[model samples]
Target: MELFFKYLQYEKRYSPHTLTSYHTDLGQFSQYLEQVYQITEPAEADHTIIRSWILTLVQNNIKPRSINRKIACLRSYYRFLLSQQQISVNPMVRIKAPKAPKKLPAFVPEESFNTLLDSFEFEKSFEGQRDRLILEFLYGTGIRLAELIGIEENDIDMRAKTVRVLGKGNKERVVPINDSLLSCIEEYLQYKKSEFSDNNSEKLLVTNKARPLYPKFVYRVVKKYISLITTSDHNSPHVLRHSFATHLLNKGADLNAIKDLLGHSSLAATQVYTHNSIEQLKSVFEKAHPKA
Candidate 1:
């Protein structure tokens, strides 16, 4: 396990968060195997043993998507073992992951977002300004929460009107910013500089005390404001990213361009947004097409 982790850390260049998730998933599976089957070695486990673990997961009411992620962890580990010649046969060869339902990404309506930005009552405090800029930054750049938090002061180029984001797998991409968002960033930076003079932080989004932004803090901030405009129950940071992509597609932006903006490694990953776009197209066609 340590060797595999080192391989992933050094070779795959997985993020710390991703590495932690993989560690937890593997640890959980190992504990389960030991308690249920007295299996001390993962490579010695067979397909039927893996199936029982899957059954246990399902009986515990774990979501299929999450279960699939756990299974992915096992698959990768076993594949590593096989490559190292530590295991003669892969236990996951015939095991299939449970099918997860397809759910469209929830997004705020463009008009609603516009209204929120235009007329929402934000306080005159630094926190309020920071929170407002957070929303606009997420929606404007379509960056993931981690990428946003990972942003440093040096990453922003005011002259170029772009922010360089270090995305998943340590991949870096430059995301363009609009003039409005640029101005908001400028305002927030000025506030940070003046109000938190003792703060030596390099992170772009910091607290009033000039501490780096954490995940839950960002989530709560996004949830608080997004709940005012959206009741879809998914008012998280990623929802703003979805809204950003969906709005772009609706505005006739090329899918490939959107993929680049979102820092998606594959076109297939970005294609999910097309389902939302297709639904929108269907709605318009139903209302406007005269053939009916």
Candidate 2:
């Protein structure tokens, strides 16, 4: 199991966040195997045992999307074992993942974002400046949380008005920045310099203690600020991302262009934002159409 984790870390070059998820999933399965079948190795478990574990998860009301993720982890692990010739055959070959409903990504409305970014005033304190930048950066670049946390001072090219982001699977893409976000970043940097005078961290976003931002910290920041702006049930960094994509699509931005900005591997992943635009069109038609 450790070997498989190392494989994912070094060779597969999976991000720390993704590696942690895989570890957690594999750990749970190993624990299940220990309690149920007394099998120490996940590799030793056959299809019946794996199927039974998945069945129990379903009975426990696990969502199909989450179950599919676990299934994907096992499939990858077994493929690794097969590559090492440690297993004679893949046990996941016969396993079928349940179909998950396709739901549109939740996003903040443009008016909410406009009021937050343009109308409402953020504090003049360093923390306020940083808070504004956090939301603006995510919405501006459409970068993932991990990518935002991993940002270094060197990643931004102020002259080019672009920031380089390392996406999932270690893929790198440069995203353009708007003047608003760029100004926020510049102000935040100046404040950060004064606040952390003794520190010289290269990471773009940091904590009050000058530590690089973590997932939980960023989540709390997003929740706090987003709560002030909108009554939307969703209050995470990804909502800003979805809003970025959705707003762009609504404004008639090209799909391929949005795909490149979002660093998606395929057009299908980017197409989800179009659903929001279609919803917007439906609402407009209901209001403006003369034919009832």
Candidate 3:
């Protein structure tokens, strides 16, 4: 088990959140085996045992999406064990993931976002500047929250107006930035420099005390400001990303271009935004078309 975790962390280069989820899912399954089947090692569990656990999860009212995630974790674990010859047979080969209903990602409207960014009065302090920059940076670049946290001052190339983002699986891509967003970065940099001259943290955004930005802090900042603008359930940094992609699609941007800009490995992942665009088109046709 420890070896498998090490493999995921080092060889697979899985993110911390993914590693934590895998650890938790495996631990839960291991406990279930020990209690029910008197099995100590997960590698000994057969397809039937795996199926039983999944059934138990469904009976416990676990959502299909979460159940599927756990199934994926176990599949990876068993595959690793099989590759290492720790297990003669892979249990996940026969296990199937239950279908989950697809839900569209929630996004903010362009007008609401513009109102938030343009009309919102951010203060003059460093924290205020940092908060505004956080919102603008996420919406402007459409990078993930983790990627934003991983940003270093050197990752941004002002000369080329691009930012190098380390996406999923440690893949790095350069995203272009407009002059307005670039000015926001520069202004925030000036404020950060003056506020934390002695600390000299390489990370682009920092706390009031010059510490690097964390996930919770960023979430709270996003939720606080986003709630004021619109009451969309999607109030996190990812919502801004959805808005960025949806707005671009609504404006007739190419799907492949949006996919590349979003750093998505597949076009299918980027096509979800088109659903929102299609809805917008339906709304326009219904309102403007003379035919009832």
What are the lDDT figures for the candidates, one per model? 0.91, 0.92, 0.91
Instruction: Please identify which of the two predictions, 1 or 2, would achieve the higher TM-score against the true structure.
Output: 2
Candidate 2's residue-wise lDDT over 1-292, tens digit each? 8899999988999888878888899999999999999999888999999999999999999999989999999999999999999999999998999899998899998898888889768898788898899989999889999999999999999999999989888999999999999999999999999999988899999988999999999899899888987787799999999999999999999999999999898999999988889989999999999983
User: Per-residue lDDT for 89-145 in model 1, tens only?
Assistant: 999998999999998898999999989988997876788889999999999999999
Off by over 4 Å in 3: none
Q: Quote the positional error of residue 208 for candidate 1 in Å.
A: 2.7
Candidate 1 positional error at 35, Å: 1.0
* lDDT measured at residue 207 in model 1 versus the true structure, 0 to 100: 81
Judged by TM-score relative to the true structure, which candidate is superior, 1 or 3?
3
The alpha-carbon RMSD values of the candidates against the true structure, listed in the order shown, are 1.3, 1.2, 1.2
Off by over 4 Å in 1: none
